[model samples]
Target: MDLLPLEVAKKVRRDSTLVKYTDGQFIQSRGDSKPGISIVRSGAANAGIIGMDGSVSMTTLLGPGQSFGEFTIFTELPRTHDVTAVGETEIYQMTATRFTRLYDNEPQLSRALLKTALMRSHILLEMLDAIRRLPIRERAARILQSMSHTAGNPNKLECRQSELAYTLGVSRISLNRGLKQLAELKLIELGYGEIRIPRPALLSDWVANHCNPAPLAS
Candidate 1:
């Protein structure tokens, strides 16, 4: 989902507590009973699972303006994934009680929350479809494009190759090969721990032409 509107975010910040976390600190853990929404005010957070073998499989990277923990509040369930700070991070946290109060009295807050939930659902469906139907190369391109769009930074993705491989459910070797192909195509420029798309539109157009289906016969 996109960032909340400035005024709405300001309202949320006004009612929320600002908390800081160092790198690798857990903001919320799986199965935790806390019911609160945490929005990244600075730095980033990673939501994912730690396997029994202690391997981390990151599912989502949440940057500034992105919020988490809403599902737990709505469903009255435990936190589903472990959310950890990526670096020195600041978060604005609002408890379920406070959020409910604001939600009841504020139309804009309700609309923003609903919009985030809907957008998240839509993105989840798209990710599932891409994983099922697209090749690794195309899948990588789409994901990079999505991240760039979300962050409004067409040139850089602050993500590692290993993280991308885990997200794609592919081996590091396979992901490397796919990335190499993209680099050869000059669609992306790879760096130490990031991927850069100099022209995100070109990558988007390329994915559309290759991955989109042709029109059916009349």
Candidate 2:
């Protein structure tokens, strides 16, 4: 993915600075009245709604170079979900009014925002489909496939097991168990803060066969 351009930074009316967050910090919250857009400069954050039982069902994980909360620019509605930093993070932020003007004037910026939103929808559909049709084994395999696609590499990804568990809405121990099963099946190898999928096609087949055959359109 391309760096969110420095030129785009010029378009933002708010003075840009690095905002720091500790682990489990809520950068944005559900029902928040404020309207602002944030671009991730480093580290990780998740955006999603809270369930009836107060569990967070993450819609998407934002890593370096990703942005979120742009929908606030188009409407006065409160923030749709909480954005919490998973670890120490740095983000550049701007108010919704300025972001709206930028979106109207900059075609590339608009395209970038739309692309991120679409990708988030796709990931959410995959997660929901896994819950509906996949067993634990297939869920693990499919998660690997989806992450590989998002990372654009089966060989390299900067991820942590805790982050993966949060992204999947599962416990870390559960994720570890599922991952071990995949490793025994020769589907993937887990390393410190990363996973390597030697056989992405095979894993995709496992996902296609076991998970719901089609993703729901958003």
Candidate 3:
């Protein structure tokens, strides 16, 4: 979902607590039922399901301008997925009590939350359709893109092969082949527990041409 507007973001900064997390730290776990939300102010985090088979199926990669724990806050339910930092990260936490206060004080906050929730819902449908239809290579590429941030030089993705394979619901062997191809195509560089995307746009262009049903009007 989109972030709060600049003025709104600045105002909420006072009501929230900024917390740091090291890579692999859990920001939200299945054990916690606390009503709170975490906005990624700096780095990114992964939110996913741990399957009964001990595999992880990634549901979301929340980067800067994104959030987690909204479902838990509204429903007052136990966290349904695991949220782990992608790297050293900072998040702004809003507790249910604090948010309720904000909702009562600033009506705009509720509007922002409602807008973000609606947008996320629509995006989820589009994502499911794309994931089901795209080739495995395209799917992996998409996930890699999300983790990259895409601000300036592409960053190295800090994830192991097994983890990537598990989250993507593909065999390690298949994932390896995709990584190898990405490397050969100069789209990414594979390292131990990392994949670096040097030219992020190359990956985007490949997906657009290979996976996109309609050609871009350029």
Candidate 4:
């Protein structure tokens, strides 16, 4: 639903070890078998894969208060993707045993995790639907809208054009073209490494108008 409940978060922090990383350092790797959950304490991380050709395919950005690796703890599986520090970053890491103990003692913790998993699934479904039915501009608009809504500041999104392009499964040139169109329409303003939505509602409205329509009568 929302970010992890404050009480549960406190408990997580209590049991976790504080870990720090510098810019571009890996917090976790794709095949690591360590079972633990990590919460962003400060700064940010990018969850993605670096291709053999050295291209990055970013899946999502994790800001402070976001927790990852829950599935890894539960399934005792290796990490699915690499999570790297965007800048200097701090993370709270709880081992599987400690997390399980906290989980057993806290009903709210379990519920919150379940909600987080469901929300992730819902977003994935929305992304797939958008990819199948929407154009690049509308897809960009929809994604930016979602990111801004989730961010602490609803009008600002901390993302790079390359990361956004990778998330959309588009080339940087194509994404730049779509983004420029949105800028021309005054829906967003692109900065060196961020996007500014002057009015988030306008972006949402534009996406709805362009991406959704009433079905024809049979």
Candidate 3 TM-score to native = 0.79
TM, every model: 0.89, 0.71, 0.79, 0.89
**Model 1, position 201: C-alpha lDDT score:** 84
TM-score comparison, 2 vs 4, better candidate:
4
**Predicted candidate 2 versus true structure: per-residue lDDT over 110-218, tens digit per residue:** 6677777787788778777876677666776777677666443455454667756766767889989998998898878889867788878877776676665667789
Q: Where in model 2 is the C-alpha error above 4 Å?
A: 1-6, 9-15, 48-56, 147-176, 186-218
State which candidate has the highest lDDT.
4
Give per-residue CA lDDT, model 3, range 1-218, as digits (tens).
24456676776777889999998898887768788887888877777776778777766567676777777767878888888888888899988888777768776777878877786676565456556887777777766765554212256666678877876677999989988877888888998867888778888787667765776789
Task: Arrange candidates by lDDT, descending.
Answer: 4, 1, 3, 2
* Ten contiguous residues with the weakest lDDT in model 2: 150-159
| Residue pairs clashing, model 3 | none
Higher-scoring candidate on lDDT, 1 or 2? 1
The per-residue C-alpha lDDT of model 3 at residue 197 equals 80
> Candidate 3 — which residues are off by over 4 angstroms?
51-54, 107-115, 118-123, 146-154, 214-218
* Candidate 3 positional error at 203, Å: 1.9
Per-residue alpha-carbon lDDT of candidate 4 for residues 67-99, written as tens digits (9 for 90 to 100): 889988788788899889877889998899999
Off by over 4 Å in 1: 1-7, 151-154
Clashes per model (N, Cα, C within 3 A): 0, 0, 0, 0
Candidate 1 colliding pairs: none
Instruction: Estimate, for each residue in 1-218, the C-alpha lDDT of model 1 and write its tens digit.
Output: 24456776677888999999998899999999989999888888878887787767766677788888988778999988988887788999999998988778778776777887797787677667777888898888877766665442458776778877888899999989999999999999999977889888899898788766678999
* Candidate 4, superposed: residue stretches over 4 Å from native: 1-5, 149-153, 213-218
lDDT of 3 at 82: 83
